[model samples]
Every structure is written in C-alpha cells, then in structure tokens.
Target: MPLVNIDIIEGVFSAEQKQIMIKKVTDTMVSIEGENLRGVTWVKINEVKQGDWGIGGQTLTANDVKAMAQG
Candidate 1:
C-alpha cells in the first residue's frame, strides 16, 4: 500500500479543492502502482494552524499567506 501525506496551513483550501486533491493523488498512485493498489492507496491531508506554520525564520498568519499569493 502507498501512503501519501499532505500538510498545509488551515483555511488555505476549500472543501471541494481538498477533495480534488485527494482524488488526483489517489489516481496518480493507481496509475503508477497499477489498478490493484487503488483499493489500498491512502491519502491524508493535514491542516496546521496558521501561526503554527512558517517560512524562512518567521511565523506565518493567514494574511501573510494571502499576501504571498498575491505577489
């Protein structure tokens, strides 16, 4: 079985987007590992608190992420 874990700051993605991510990841794994593993493939998404995630040496907030996306 193949296990995939994705971590992102909370509120960065909507429910539908996350669902798409899960499906796409599973499909990719199936394509690479063969159809038989489809039933055994696992994908997990973890959402961390905004301030708990950081970049460089600074802690990041939701607003910080939004600004980064705009630039």
Candidate 2:
C-alpha cells in the first residue's frame, strides 16, 4: 500500500479542486506502483487553519496564498 498525505492551508482550495488533486495524486502513485496497488493506494488532504501556518517567519492565510498565486 502506498499512502500520500497533502497538507494545504484551509480555504486555499475548493472542494472540487481537492477532489481533483486526490484523483491525480492517486493516478500518479498507481502509475509508479503498478495497477495492482491501485486498490491499496491512499491519498489524504489535510487542512491547516488560516493564520496558523507559517513560512519565512510570517503566518499565511488563504488570501496570502491567493495573492501569491496571482503573482
């Protein structure tokens, strides 16, 4: 079994986007691990609350991420 965990700031992604991410990640794993492991592959998305995730000594929120994406 292959397990993949993805962590992202809450509100940074829509529900549909998250689902797409899971599917894509699973597909990538299956491609590398073989079709036999598809059933045992696991992909999880973890959300970190806004203002609770920090990088470069500054807390980041969904808006901050959005701004970065825009740039």
Which candidate tops lDDT?
A: 2
Model 2 lDDT on a 0 to 1 scale: 0.96
Compared with the true structure, what per-residue lDDT tens digits does model 1 show for residues 14-63?
89989999999999999999999999999999999988987788998877
- Model 1 lDDT vs. the true structure? 0.91
Query: What is the clash count of model 1?
Result: 0
Query: What lDDT is reached at residue 56 by model 1?
Result: 87
Error of 2 at 44 (Å): 0.5
Give the Å error, residue 10, model 2. Answer: 0.4
The number of the candidate with the highest TM-score is 2
Local accuracy of candidate 2 as per-residue lDDT tens digits, 1-71: 98899999999999999999999999999889899999999999999999999999999999999999999
